[model samples]
Target: MIPYTLPEVLRLVWSLVWQQIVQHAQVVAWSLFRRHHQAVAQVYHYKRRLALNTS
Candidate 1:
């Protein structure tokens, strides 16, 4: 087994942790964007229906 120095070990761990954080963040952002898009579409449809009813 290759012995890693302290800094090297820390760097390896940090990279792994950072990758996990970035992946989690991407997933969260995508979900939020999808939800917001759905909400906007719903609102647009509701407004269109209201306009049709009024006119």
Candidate 2:
């Protein structure tokens, strides 16, 4: 039987952690982007409604 060295195990763990970090970052970025888009759309809609009321 063969055994993995300590360095090999550490490397594997590091790779998994890095992958998780990248995935979480992408999720957070998309969430923020979506929130920003929704906020902008709401502002535009509010402004349009206000203008219509004034006219």
Candidate 3:
């Protein structure tokens, strides 16, 4: 087996760490977007229901 030098090992580790960070950020962003969409939808539905009831 070929031995990896220190720089190569560090580079590999850094890449893996960066990939994980990017993945986590993506997950967080999507979750926040979904939550906001759901909240907006709920508010819209509530308003529609209220308007219908009062009519």
Candidate 4:
């Protein structure tokens, strides 16, 4: 077994943790963006329907 120094072990652990954090952040951001766009689209459709009904 190769013995890693303390700093090396810490660096490895930190890199793994950072990767997970970045991935989670990306997933969260994408979901929020999709939700916002869906909300906007729904509002647009509702407005269009209202205008059609009023016309």
Q: Distance (Å) between predicted and true CA of 39, model 2? A: 0.5
Give the runs in model 2 whose Cα sits over 4 Å from its true position. Answer: 1-22
Tell me the deviation in Å of residue 10 in model 1. 33
TM-score for every candidate vs. truth?
0.55, 0.59, 0.60, 0.59
lDDT of 2 at 45: 100
lDDT of candidate 4 over 1-55, digit per residue (tens): 8899999989998888765555888999999999999999999999999999999
Query: Arrange candidates by TM-score, highest first: which order?
Result: 3, 4, 2, 1
Stretches off by above 4 angstroms in model 3 are 1-22
lDDT of 1 by residue, 8-47 (tens): 9889988887655558889999999999999999999999
Per-residue C-alpha lDDT of model 3 across residues 1-55, encoded as one tens digit per residue: 8999999999998888765555888999999999999999999999999999999
Model 2, residue 30: what's the lDDT? 97
Worst 10 residues of 4 by lDDT: 16-25
lDDT of each: 0.92, 0.92, 0.92, 0.92
Off by over 4 Å in 1: 1-22
Worst 10 residues of 3 by lDDT: 16-25
lDDT of model number 4: 0.92
Instruction: Please provide, for model 2 over 1-55, each residue's C-alpha lDDT reduced to its tens digit, 9 standing for 90 to 100.
Output: 6899999989998888765555888999999999999999999999999999999
CA lDDT of 50 in candidate 3? Answer: 100
